[model samples]
Target chain A: MQDVHTIGKYADFAVGDIRTFAEACGVTLSVTLLSLLIGTVIGIIFGLIRCSKNKLIRFLPLIIMEPLRNSPLVVQLFLVYYGLPVMAGILLKDYTAAIITLSLNTAAFFGVLVHNSILAIPVSQWEAGYALGHGKFSTFINVIARQALRLLIPQAITLYIGQLQCSSIVSLISLRDITRVGQLLSVRTMRPFAVWGIVFGLYYLVSFPLARLADYLAKRIDYTY
Target chain B: MAMIEVKNVTKQFGDLTVLDNFSVDFDHSGVTVLIGPSGTGKSTLLRCINGLEKIDEGDILVDGLSVNNKKNLKQIRKTCGMVFQQTVIFPHMNVLDNLTMSPIKLLRMSKAEAEDKARYYLDKVGLASKEKSRHNELSGGEQQRIAIARALMMSPEALLLDEITSALDPEMTREVLNILVNLAKEGVCMLCVTHEMSFAKEVASRILFMEGGKLVCDVSKDDFFGSVREENERINKFLSFIGE
Candidate 1:
């Protein structure tokens, strides 16, 4: 393992480290996009289900969400990467397992956000729907969900960036994400600080724009009506 | 035939007993003002008719469709439109979209047709030029008028208005009341809950008085203002209190 070094000597390995870190960043971006897309869709569907009047349907998502939310992410990664093959005789490639676990974890959190946002809407909104003769599902999709969207997006985007950061946990299962690439380069070059610093910079490069976009969207949300 | 019938309905909120064995039938062609003190279940009755609140016992029929029966609930709601005490406009929608949403979504009207209809109703409510205005940007009076126009777009057999003016200033209240008066003149069956006694006297065919979750008086407008005064001390006290 490399020792932590100062930025003074980082110049030595900067150019070659750039190539490696950039490629790792590409891998991170690909997985993050795929995970966020899947997570958001699943989150919306399951979140609405979680708020459903049907007792069992509402409870069923919570059963899945509870473990995904409370347990460790690294543990979940291992369970999907290793435990699934043993239990079901169906092995997921390391990258596939990483995507699945990251997406599910993100979905669980986003789903809860969706539920809370929907709940925050006044009951009168739902009554307006009823008085308008919209059925339960239509009322939810058109009336309740539309209003909840303004409340959900700011929080969801913030959590989405958190998911982007948390995606690094996939490296524990050997998926060659930015952190994994950083680790490999760190060992080969014997300069932990330089390697990890570039990795950190790459993550910030990816995340900073999203955070700015969230703020922009939050401002625009006030003008939604 | 009655436009709406509430037959021995009971509603309880954890033993609070908001409406106890309540019953009333609203005629097919008249304005009925439900006058009551606060917490008297008048609003509950309006909500019950619209199926916004469930009755613990008995049946509410709108256009002969039962409010509680699952098969008829949708039709019942369509028959009876409700405007809330609080201004419940969808802040995310502009006035045009607000009026058109249910017509397009529930009535399956084409967007262009719904938009045209929205314009017509907005015109009726004196907001023809405010179609593109967002809900939160409008005055409270404008919002309540838009709410009325939205209900009118559904072409409900009866309208249940729960103190639609409670949040408005007097000028704003008058604007909304003016629209209601026009609807009443058009003979739209309406059950309204309000403290606006003069408007009730001016428009109501029958004035139903409720107190402590029970109907204490159901009289013709003339009788309610005239001879019916001698019938009940509580009614007289309530009328006097509100300066009727």
Candidate 2:
């Protein structure tokens, strides 16, 4: 039929522009990786602060996390990308804006994950460490943290995949990520279906391997005790 | 100085006073068993001596270091190795690592030296072959024995055991108690909170009975198992209740 021929022709057009898509995929990956690294560091610092015994110190993380978590990522992107230049007279490049917004967003969620993971361990473990003459800091790093890693691995993978998929939103800031590249190609060829399908496949290509790595790690640390 | 001195200590959990004006002194080396009805503050006394629980009044001294001072806590804890009823071996580590980690990190012992001591204690507890086993891989009795070895690796002056055999089956209890008996004969200073009357009779040099946060009787084991039971109706009733 004519529809089948039209689909084949659009698919050929999409395949011909694979190099540009590949470059954009590279951009997406780099941005996600950078943000993930920075976000994890920020998240752990805030999570430890959140677990503080003092009331004032424990409240610190919530000041940043509440707004970032409650607001949509798109709004956050717009606020940083568009609002900063006008209000503060400080302009950021599109990539900088994307990375800042994405990292803060990831930090907000990952902070809570770290807090819950640390809390999931029993107080008895801390006591055992202390009974053996370890101080509070030593107990946390040597005893509590190792056990918490088991609780963290599965949830951290889910978060990583989420951040990866969420990075597609960077295209709205004109960062030329894979989604942006897909947008331009679909507009030019008038082939939304074929172009979007390829984008979906590319995202899957990155995510599947990460999921497998998580599986391997989870099994390695898993034990009945 | 006594190995451990509890000088008129009081401890409270919210409104409920667990230990009130309780005092005792442990000599440098002997087995002293604390026996009483449940919730009579025997375990609280052990915890206070180890600096696990803070006392509301008075103080505890371990190896002449006051538990009241923050600076003394680390040294005090190092001198008093505590084993809990729940068998808290670090699950993330194998038995050898669990035994060796504290000595290497805290005492700054070389790994070779720490491992050497760990093997000696592991052999003493009859768990020499379990060095490579994970905590979860061991049975309840084996885990408790490993816990004892872990405590011994630090070369503590005294061991504080709080209801250690309370959670085990009779067979497992026998296994752990056998190790404790051996440790007793070896002249390890031990302050044990337990309900195993026969085990207490066999190993206890002194017996301290408590009730309602007060020391009811402190007697030598023979006197406690003999005359004190006949003299104190409350102690006699408690002994009968526990099927002793």
Top candidate, metric DockQ:
2
TM-score of each: 0.91, 0.95
DockQ of 1: 0.55
True contacts kept of each: 0.79, 0.79
lDDT by residue for model 2 (A75-99), tens: 9999999999999998999999998
Candidate 2 per-residue lDDT, tens place, B80-194, comes to: 9999988898888899999999999999999999999999999999989999999768999999999889998888888999999999999999999999999999999999999
Poorest lDDT segment (10 consecutive residues) of candidate 2 chain B: B58-67
Off by over 4 Å in 1: A1-19, A82-92, A223-225
Ten residues in sequence with the least summed lDDT for candidate 2 chain A: A7-16
Off by over 4 Å in 2: A1-16, A219-225
